[model samples]
Target: MSRISSFVEIYFPGVAQRFQKGIALIDERYGVKAMYGLFFNFCLNVSRPGQVDRLHCLPHADYKNLALAVCVVFVYGEFNHKEKCWLVMWEAGIILQIPPGVFVAYPSALFYHFNFDISNLEVCVTDGADFPTPQNSRRLDGGASGRGSCVWFNQASMWQTAEIGVDTIKQAISQGLDATCDNQAFLDSLVFAKIMGDKGQPQPTL
Candidate 1:
């Protein structure tokens, strides 16, 4: 079993574009939002290579919850954690354009980091439930290979006990499990462990 070191969690919701466009127009025309409301917790790292000063943004450790809607206007950074490497992970729906008048919460986690470069992009974050800290607290200091593992024992058990579909199981694993172990059996064991751990008994096989 792999131990978790550090990780981050980001939540996105579906909304309409017209509403987002109107909010964007308001932000562009008046600049009042930036001055009065909470700002985006992420920063626009212009020093990175191929990073335009006004085209992207990056989330830092300081990303607390704000009170406005926000989206990833653009993405350009190195996923390999190498020097001068730039990539765009989100293309279409991956970059969510949120509208105003919505409740958005940005919780702080172990892997609290993101990158973007854009202008007039606004978002609000607010505090919610108490943040969860890893049992072994440490910062991630490597490339994609350096990601910490995520273990969802109790929840995984509940889902499997309900005999959820395989696709649902896969999706839950992708979101809750560590990204490193993408194999089928490893994922199956994780789900099984989650269920058995909750029941305080050994995992049973058919």
Candidate 2:
């Protein structure tokens, strides 16, 4: 267990179990779990600390050791739903400006969500792509990485907020990604749009 995980478990016993139960509730209420066609692991884990915000899509299948998977992100920011179908996908939508200290548990693989410009953050949660089945028809960018969520950002928003200049843009490009390079060009397009936005010009629709 990570130092953070040990601390949480010792100081906050049953919290992981509570979240698991909550996922069950989400399944009951929105059937997010049913869409995966398999069960998910609620083994709480600590996410790597990040100071910047991100937005991206992902697939939950194969999140952990399971054949298929899902995840719940407890982030203090907006988590928008990319897909529309409830049973086949997470009940898709967006919750703007999510307050701090709030937990948003979700099937990170099943739902493509993004983070707003909330900074100095640490996301603490567990990998949940435990579904045992074939990959879904719509494959998310960084689903295989088990990092859940492409960490892709909304272009207009990222451009408007990050204050990313030529140097920053160059840096993100050098890494071959804007928050989620692993997702490839399909996701990188958002960064390009943001760059265009910085120019005060209309970005071409994807």
Candidate 3:
């Protein structure tokens, strides 16, 4: 997790700073790291060796997560990433071809996203093919081939508490802030800091 955090800090410095700010706020509020205070969590998609039906999900938005914050996902494992595990984003109308050990960050609360099915295509040529099968997919140490994702995100409640002095929209409204007027203004005031790239250019957005 430290290494992944460092990588994001190096490449996506703005995102790293945003996460750290949130973490600091939460830690200060609770006087300790909460049980779910971690910036990243692992989800191992394990299955039978070479199983083409590995775990997946339907298109959905993570409504409970912070809307202004981005979710960072790190995909890794021994599966054939080239043919399988592409990320399908409905709002973007694009399927991202993320190779193994790569990291992708997006606003999960805004985009409806899912994954492609595990590849079932058979390889005809061996020149540069990545065809993992039951017989050859197992590691020498007998570990099964599978995929895993590490997701980093901030919960909506944490940000709400930090920014609005409350942990829920209802609480904020009850405290005299109008949801459609003052709430949107408060959200607008909480802008992400602009990040400049090494070449003096603004960082690109997804």
Would you list the clashing residue pairs of candidate 3? Answer: none
Which one is best on TM-score? 3
As a whole number from 0 to 100, the lDDT of residue 185 in candidate 2 is 35
Model 2 scores worst on lDDT over the 10 consecutive residues at 144-153
For candidate 2, write residues 34-149 as lDDT tens digits. Answer: 22212233332222326323333333332222111123333332233222111123236554443333333333434544432222123222235554334422323221111222
Query: Stretches of candidate 1 above 4 Å error?
Result: 1-44, 48-59, 65-70, 76-111, 114-206
Better of 2 and 3 by TM-score: 3
**Model 2, residue 199: C-alpha shift (Å):** 50
lDDT, candidate 3, 1-206, per-residue tens:
66666755665565566667767776777664633333633444545555543545677999988675567787777766656667888988988877778888787998999987434344322333568666556322212247766677766766666655566679888999754424464444443434688999886544
Each candidate: what lDDT? 0.28, 0.32, 0.64
Candidate 1 lDDT tens digits, 39-152: 212333333334432222255432232112223222233333231122223322133332221222322221233432222233222233544345423333323321111111
Query: Model 3 — which ten-residue stretch has the worst lDDT?
Result: 136-145
